[model samples]
Target: MSRRHLAMLTATVLAAASLTACGSGDEPGDGGKTLTYWASNQGASLEADKEILQPELDKFEQQTGIKVNVEVVPWSDLLNRLLAAATTGQGPDVVNIGNTWSASLQATGALVEFDDATLDKVGGKDRFVPAALAAAGAPDKPPAAVPLYSLAYALYYNKQSFADAGITAPPTTWEEMAEAGRKLTGDGKWGLAVEGANPSENAHHAFTFAQQYGGEWFDAAGKPTFDTPQNVAAVKRYVDLMAVDKIVNPSNAEYAQNQSVSDFANGKAAMLLWQAAGANLKSQNMAADAYGVAPVPFLANPPAGGKQVNSMVAGINIAVFKHTKNLDGALEFVKFMTSDTEQVTLNKTYGSLPAVGTVAADPAFAADEQKVLAQTLATTAAPLPQVPEESTFETLVGTAIKELFADAASGRPVTEDSVREKLTRAQQQMR
Candidate 1:
């Protein structure tokens, strides 16, 4: 899922409460001809997503005589809304979910499990990408959802900024990236833009950094190991980008709503670490040729246990609520959405890679940006720990990072001790 739509901690807690209250309910009548869908906001704006999706819904309606009433839910309210629906059994028949929430939501037992027999209704298990499928739910359990759109993080750099800085190529190592950032940071322009205040964004970077630092957020039992030495070092390293390195603008410490993306689009920043940023850039009027894409940088010198991973498996998944009266219509809609034709069409418009394997060779996804993201997703990306507590982990740990960013932006020293303190508090809360 894009960082742009990650829900806040409070909303997640409320949703979690609602999920605990979920129970089997009597099915309501829908006449078996209509389905309600709650889609994530994937475009530049809510209206933009509706404009892009309504046509496809209409196409499905024409083909199957089943109408889809779609609502583009903002990330802030999506999880809460879904949880309420799960508790009351009165929500949309079909919904889009952040892939990381698969295990957490699946634990509610309110979703229809896509076992082999159930999957046969929608193309079959072989039709999807393996990595994407793996993220749909916990291992050894039938997935609660199927991959809809695929994404991975990449480094987006301003081509002109690099040329002006006399840089010949994009950085492949973190040290090189910092060096380049130094050169790019002058004359009112900053080296990079980061969404410092966004907990979801912070957690995503934290996960990647922890992997590169030979750390894990959870142990073998799925318990949080957040305040470990490796994790402390990882969190400190990220906040130091502003507090110590001085490469990022201090003002960015409060950027939770994609102001960093705006900065990159307007050339106020030279680089961005983001997932599938092309469509968003285009929406901001940044030309296709204005920037270049490359795999996210890794450590110049990794520790003993450090992995080569650079990104987390990130994307959206589609699921059917078990309480839906129109189960057949809902399954048909899932089939329609994940079909190869729709995969190419929708993924292309959203600047995401197709989740279905059959569309991997489609010419629409042959662009440079897509290639970089595809390579990362296939090679270096690892999914977040697929535990039932994954959503709470995101909230607690992500908010910890957010608070640390606040300290950095406010001119406070960001030491390993401070990082450890924040992480320790988060872990304590999880208990």
Candidate 2:
């Protein structure tokens, strides 16, 4: 299963009381010393998350003398629960947010923006991975959150399947990938597993493919560029895997990201586009030697200066609700969570990359997949556009791809004109 790299929620209004409540250290019913934290579930289950995090919380409390209340919220509920709390001027002192939502949430004025002085308290901005920190918020403003954990997408292929098909190496260009896919498809199996039903997963792929084809999602002024000719071509190319190239299974239109990963792990498909799928694949009893990792394939005929790119720097970020009464303690906890010790411990257990650069030296991250992701992060990967409407972009663009997938699956014509129509509607809607 794909890890919950980001869980975008609809932005909501913060209560009137929240404006003054934040950073004030003044609330009526509770003492300011106790800090409340809403942690995203990081382990197999909510209970498992609690077990993993409580010991760390205990250590923090012992050192700081601040009582900490912890709640493990499932991904489905975390956003709405935060909305409810913000509406009531009552929420956790610190909480986890999808890094991509930082800009959207920042627009609501609900999260604390870390300034130079406050950032200094957390060991300065130099401690974090540059690409990871860049995803926290916009370039011109203080970031609404700081990266907590990180991830990048990679190509995961079935080694035995490749050997059986007589392919000695993973394809480096899109043309070679298509050729390899054609050769790998047969005997009741597919060459590639695609996640058509999962909108976010589709959106992530759109970003990578569009970028590879020299298509930008937003113009210089940050206006929607959804229907551009280049983007249309990119979307068509992706859909062609099923509709034209016939390398992917048409039935895969029903697959979500998890189902796609399952297909690859179970030998129903030869290749998968995924991030940090190791732990989940292991859970499904897949052997380590069965699969191999490679950089995501790029375009064979990229425009001048264009190079292969993979994913937006994806991960969760930790933010403080600006309205928390225990201002000092909340800030302290933020520092503690992003500290070197905790970053290593949490990311190690979660099967994710650490936000802090120094922590990457740990042996736990020395796997081949981790190395490829690390190289990509340092070289070609980028964050989602740091615009206030990034979440909307994800929703609108993802839905467009979903519509295309539906057409291909149902035997409807997926013409360039139809692609433009869907994309234009999504673009105009964004206006």
Best by TM-score: 1
Residue-wise C-alpha lDDT for candidate 1, range 1-431, written one tens digit per residue:
21222233334555555432211122245347777788998877788899999999999999998888888987766776775666566678899999998987787777999999989999999999999999999889999999999999999999999999999999999889889999999999999999887777888999999999999999999888999998998888888888887789988888875688889999999999998888889999999999999999999999999999999999999999998877888899999999988999999999999999999999999999999999999889999999877877777888898888888888999998889999999998777
lDDT of 2 by residue, 1-431 (tens): 00111223323323223322123234355467677788886554678778889999999989988867788886545655655554455667898987876886676677788988878877799988877888888888888888998888888999988998899999988788899999999989999999887666777788788888788888888888999888888888888888887788888887754677778878999998887777667766788778999988888888754546767777889998878776678888988998988988887777688998888899988888888888887777877777777766777788788889889989998999998998899888777
**Model 2 weakest lDDT span, ten residues long:** 1-10
Candidate 2: pairs in clash: 22-322
Q: Which candidate gets the maximum lDDT versus the true structure?
A: 1
Which ten residues in a row are the worst by lDDT in model 1?
Answer: 1-10
Error of 1 at 156 (Å): 0.1
Cα lDDT, model 1, residue 187: 94
For each of the candidates, the C-alpha root-mean-square deviation to the true structure, in angstroms, is 4.2, 5.2
Candidate 2, lDDT over the whole model:
0.79
